[model samples]
Target chain A: MASRILGRLPLDEDRLAQDMARLAQAPAPQEPYEVFTIGRWVNLNLWNASGDDGDGFFNGHRQVAGRPTRLLGGVPYIGELLTTWFNTELLTMVRARNVVEWSIVPHRDFLESGPAEDFFRVLVFLEDNEHALNSDEDMVFHMRKGEVWFLDSAQIHAGVNISSRSRWSLCLDFKAGAGFSPGDVFARAGDYDPAIRPALVERAPAPADLPDRLRALSAVVSRHNIKDIAFLLGKVHFTEEVPIGASWDWLVEITRASGDPALLDLAERARRFFVHSREVYEEFSFVPA
Target chain B: MASRILGRLPLDEDRLAQDMARLAQAPAPQEPYEVFTIGRWVNLNLWNASGDDGDGFFNGHRQVAGRPTRLLGGVPYIGELLTTWFNTELLTMVRARNVVEWSIVPHRDFLESGPAEDFFRVLVFLEDNEHALNSDEDMVFHMRKGEVWFLDSAQIHAGVNISSRSRWSLCLDFKAGAGFSPGDVFARAGDYDPAIRPALVERAPAPADLPDRLRALSAVVSRHNIKDIAFLLGKVHFTEEVPIGASWDWLVEITRASGDPALLDLAERARRFFVHSREVYEEFSFVPA
Candidate 1:
């Protein structure tokens, strides 16, 4: 799985800081929550499918439960700003406040059951501290304040806070049919003033398990998975010390045996470019001269 | 054009060095030669099509012109060593001795006319200095003593001796149908003792002219040139900031417009892998953000 930085939001830092300070001074959670084994982290649901303040079912069509009395406290500026910035039909909005030294277990959302298409989860960091969102394939995103990201919820991810002070973030879930995508956000982010634009750092994921992963993918060959599997084979050929002939042979044999013309064509292209020595040498016998 | 380090040859370095020393002490070239305006370098033809001593046609079947009178004068070790090492039917042989502070202009070999297939030119460096052979895509190979290389004659290449000491190398041409290839040599090179293996340094070629090159290739769409043109497009897409979508779009349009299904399939495979962001972003407008 690959994750990209969609871009940053343009929120006035001074006003956001003031709003956060006011929210922090509010009288605790307006509703009770269950404690977990890791630590005590509180969730304030601003909107959900059910009108109640309790943590409601997190999927399907949702409506604004009620006014954000605990944080917004009848204030209209922040709500208007969020509604305008997101520019979509809001399904659910939640303020997740993580206690110091606490972390959420890695897990995927809306996997077992969900709508036909995938939805987007946009995160707006309220306070800056040593907190990170670790996702699939060991990708870590150290989100900073005033930054916005469209997190891929299908991938297993976790939110962690190891700062001395508590951390807070606003997570907004928009309906998949809202006609918004990460690509749009990414392009829009580039339009922001350079001074306040958030930095997007993408780390190349380590391929320690690539061999095993490739083997697994090859075992279950299908049209949907063939492209990715072929790409991985090319990646392995170029970046690894594995013999080029061996890789070419494997791809040729597997794709041919699968009897998929597309895969076979892909294999041919892979041979032409990724696998060197295809053009110059017909048979590369290792006999020393 | 791309060049690969096919492999290394095994030779008795001590005996070869002794023969080189004996050859160096010899008076001068045993045959007549021509001096070019580029530099003071000289060519001594050891063998050619004609029995007379002169630089004859460099390709096709040939016989030894005469004895290597100056270097191999009464010395059988070097001749026997070369005959045994090459171990194939020879077409032509020449002793290229470059004077100090001289260079050869960049050019391709056998471009005007040649056999149906390409021939191999094996260079055995008799004396080593700070000399280099620059070839396709800015690749440079520094030939060392007792080292043999199958130079890619079809690509533009040049030899340079920047050092004050004169450089000498024996050039041997072998029939391409002799069942020897760079791939076979490259695979076998790994078995050689690491110390004797020549270093192949590849420099990144500037892609400033890539767009123009690609345009020219698209104009002359032929089966013979399609593969190379596709490979170059892949190279540009992977290594350059040119948007992958743009590349895919151009390839699809050109190959389809050319009415070549094979090229179209090749373009499809290219888009599947080399052109990233293909599946993610559909409409990649080149407009900034």
Candidate 2:
């Protein structure tokens, strides 16, 4: 299942309040910070460990599977600062494995109306909302001070001023390290079917015994070995004459890896005698570039 | 509005077919090509253009976008070939000031089960599909040996091919230069609005003259000049102090820019200055990065 690790940090509310005041009025200068600021607003988002992309709303617009820049356009106290704290804290809590080394979801995706499954989302607060937590879903908790609230992202949520007074807290979203499996986060990767036309039946048949070349091909397929599958396709000889598709299938059946795209692509590319008996000049089985 | 520019090259079916073959067989070239033999083939979807943002789908997907090996996976065909063909065939043939340059439309978001305006679309290729066109959405005109057809991606559409024999053509989702407004294309840029609980009241005296600062802000706003409006906010004195939830409205009212994010963002940030009095310091405003 998709898993997430959580933790917290001691916040300096006094410093935060003072920082907020700086945004309100120009105070006497003490010294510049590591990053000079009108305030302590740091852009927090799903960036690589390298810390390349600067924070803003535009980065979060188009959320695809892996490259999800989930948050955007928010002040630091609520997001980036919290995440930075979490990352630093995570470093100390557990020394290694399945550890999330970065990012955090302070706010989530939710709209007033939509389908049940899409009604609630873990919305990244920034551009494109790059990736959205599924609606009709919830994470274990949303971060809160004193005690932590395993926020079920399923709730329609946004950052609101719970108090006229601003609150300061740490937040984090960590990518699982070596001990973690991304696909495991969801379910194990599905048993995806290849582009086999299930409706179409292969008509090729075989004798109980195998021929030498056919045997060699047979050895190639069973192991899910792509290169060997291609090798056998060019080398094997069929006892029963079969059509193009069936001939291909029979080769794969004997080798065990026949229909896999990896093998098929190789056969189509490798400079060898095509099943059609012609020495294809165009190994890719197509015309010139 | 979104924009683009598309050009044409005489079908070097022979050359393309050849190059495609080489690339397909070359152990996953990293540039623009995706797959050559697999039934489902595609091109590039470079999620890292904005850099690696793990927050959403827009980041990167080795699956759909193709992984870069020899730098050929998801790369556009950038060479004398595309350049010469584009400039000579399309751009030169037709000239215009601004065309659809780059655009993306959230097709999945706008899909409608039933045919709808500004909704999900399905491109159903009916009986004798050969009579019209073969491109997924009539991206451009499709002219085969005998017939010609115009492409239309106005709604949710999917293709159904009942032809007995296998037909050959390329199927891909790419942004090409176009004479049409990019906004009209699939996945073109669109917009969203934030919830605003605005409190607006015409003053009791029915003031004949708005203050000079307000008038100046209004002028800058009229020109859609948010930066200048921001500049004004840095130097304005309001006769009526801004009310809560109305900070954004104040900035817009005081400026000439229209009600847009750039303007609203300025107002939202200004709210961070919600102190009872401006006693501590002066000249603190939201300085955009």
Candidate 3:
């Protein structure tokens, strides 16, 4: 399995506060895909191809990781933690995502990019948010503070933070092959103990007539509320029994019933842009171009 | 007895290289005072009132120590080191100065500002520079990598880096009364060890014709070369057995011999502005206003 608990790092509240205080001085830049999130979801570059702190996007042409940016320097403990990973050469883009009262739509990453098998992903929870939840194709889970997990991003995955507090996590992208394993990444730490495994999320069964209830959104769906409706639909997958991809299907169904061709096209395009093939800079808009 | 040895920190080359690599990407900002140095003299703020990485100058009004700036976050080990201080509340502004082919002219700091006795200055040499030399009123010494010293900025002092390599040092300003002592600052470090104390800088006696040699600079010193000549004279104190303040005196004498009324006034004004009362933001320019 690509996803499993790897190891953990020592938690230091003072160090986290220092990093948080520095980040608080400036507002986080908005990510390009606005419709993918309901509330604030900021992706800050910790290590990337250009080694520039201000650069959050990946430069596909130059896919080489350089030195840590100034942002990483300010959070020295994080920088020191990165050094502990043995196969650092396999790493590429490393970023910290801080989500506050946000819900991310279900999507498969690297669908239009490099070979999914060659990419490995890791996630470390910097803080524990009780209401935060994440799900992959098969399982939903909650990552606790300092817990490091091998996140399988190639699978359809989504996240939600219903709480007002922030959920901070470091997402590490590694370009590696079948030979690379968790052992290589956690070489400095001892072999993982089975006791640290995550508990499966207990989600409620989908209510009968759920589709009819979702279809009811068609009456209220407008050009203005279309994006919010789509995000709200995505959030349903976290609490109820439904296929992760059902969120997009519901969006498409709701918009088609609206009798607005433009609304239907927007819903379809958003699904494709977020989960299927999307041009590098392709952006989905509520208004037809 | 304002300046003395404190203690040392563990030297980590990889950590140092990590910080140096990040700093190397961007040119360090020039300090406010220009005439005091010969080459690149960058004073970067690690901690200050505003907690802004870009601000290097001290704001005398708000004399409170705030959170570490983005710059300090990038150097996490340095941040950790700062926390080791027992009396961090007493600190106001802490900065790191990097000098490359630079020499600071002899002058007393805090002369026109806060009570000199209340300000406790500490210097920690970040790297070893064989050619770097610093002088207080009576003694000149070369600080090595990781060595921490209590610097007396109230007395006449100067620094020079004759080497092409960079000399980086952390300068901390603490506000306290007679109750505060080096014991409190180094409480975590235990009692001082006499074995690690610095060696005094060896110097030759001043040349018999030193006065005439400096006075003869009147022939070559002009508006274009006056600042450079002043810095060169300041550098002389690093090599010869002359009082630290002789650099300013030599400048005044050279300008008097030049018989240029404007040049004489400029020299006197430069001396006064640096070592005496200078209204905040008052800049000394070669061009007469």
* DockQ per candidate, 2 decimals: 0.01, 0.02, 0.01
lDDT of 1 by residue, A1-289 (tens): 3444455666776777676665554322322221110222445555555444444345433333323434444334556566566543443554545443334433345443354245667677776774343333334556786677666666544454433355777776665545654544332344433244334335444356544434433333443233323323322322233432444555666677667777777666545433232321122111101
Q: How well is candidate 3 docked (DockQ)?
A: 0.01
lDDT of 3 by residue, A1-289 (tens): 6467777777779977777666544434324454455444667777887787767765433346545777787777777778775356767877878775567779877665566777678888888877788998787899888888888877878887755466788888776667765666654647443358785788889878788766866654655346555666777767778888888889999899978888898888888887787655655554432
Model 3 C-alpha lDDT per residue in residues B1-289, reported as the tens digit of each score: 7466777777678877787666544434434564455444667788887787766676653456656788888887777778874357767778877775556778877765666767678888888888788998898898888887888877888887754466888888776567766656553647444357686888889878778756766654555345555666677767778888887888999899989988898889888877776665665554332
C-alpha lDDT score of every prediction, in listed order: 0.46, 0.25, 0.71
Clashing pairs in 1: B6-B185, B6-B186
User: How many backbone collisions does model 1 have?
Assistant: 2
Mark the 10 consecutive residues where model 3 chain A has the least summed lDDT. A26-35
**Weakest ten-residue segment in model 3 chain B by summed lDDT:** B23-32
By DockQ, who's the top model here?
2
TM-score of chain B of 3: 0.91
Quality of model 2 by C-alpha lDDT = 0.25
